[model samples]
Target: MNAERLVRRMIDVGALRFGDFLLSSGKRSRVYVDVKLASTFPDILEMIADGIAEKLSGVEFDRVACVELGGVAIAVATSLKLKKPLVIFRKEEKSYGVGGDRIGEIRKGERVVVVEDVITTGRSALSAARRVEKSGGVVGAIIAVVDREESGREFMSLLKLSDLIKAYDSFDTTKS
Candidate 1:
């Protein structure tokens, strides 16, 4: 799908939110990409998966990894689309039966691409990449559905903050 169409859908679904918000990075922002909301809609989620998959088409990776709460849906969809294995990381390690921080196995030296819903400071994605490294997986890339463009981190994303902001501005102008 085209970027404009995806942005429109995101707006229609109330996924791209505006106004003051506190990000996971502990920073304040007026714009927030609520990809978790988008995931609730299968069509939107599919578009997201398509975008991520396209980004990884040329990149080589053995598995896709992401943390729970937000990135799970996108990662799952992308993993399915690419027919690749998925590795999920928990924000906190579990203490119960078969306890561990991750859900799937990562073979030694397997290349991994860390997936995230949004990239702000990139701490979340980077942390997942580090975990992949610790688990004996090589970090191939860090990909997100949207890049907030705040961190200046080297990563791949389907859409950037500027794209959303431009679309939002045009939307507001049309509404006026």
Candidate 2:
């Protein structure tokens, strides 16, 4: 997948916005990328999944675990593209039903990759990873759609859309 093309598409779809804004982390920012909106488009979602899958081509992971809400769709697309099973992690354990925080069959000691839409504080992804570890699964890596360039907690290994961001800045979408 072409990262530049993906980035341009994200801009066209109003996923990336430039303005002074407050973030969920309570920080001020000049740019905000709502990847959830981008994921709503099947073509863009497929590009995102393909990009992530390509990045993880050689990486070893038994399952793709996604945090609740934002990461759900992208995770599903990525899991399908990679032909790997998916595990969903809730922000908190469900009160009803199975009464568990996680949904899906995850084997103990299985290697897992955490997928997320955006990484700001990195808490959501980290929390998901912690849950995986607590459940006896090993977290191999964390993948996100955008990094937001915010100084936050770093993961042991992370794959982000840095190249895409650079492309967005350098490429002129008007000419295309």
Best by lDDT: 1
Q: For candidate 1, write residues 38-151 as lDDT tens digits.
A: 888988888998888888889999999999978999999999999999999999999999999989999999999999999999999989988999999999999988999999
Candidates' RMSD to native: 1.1, 2.9
Task: Give me candidate 1's TM-score against the actual structure.
Answer: 0.96
lDDT of each: 0.90, 0.82
True-vs-predicted CA distance for residue 123, candidate 2, Å: 1.4
* lDDT for each residue of candidate 2 in 1-176, tens digit (9 for 90 to 100): 87767788887888877789897778887777888999999999999899889878888999999988899999999999999999998888889977988889678989999998988788788888888898899998888887765645554322344555566577656654
lDDT for residue 2 in candidate 1, whole number 0-100: 76
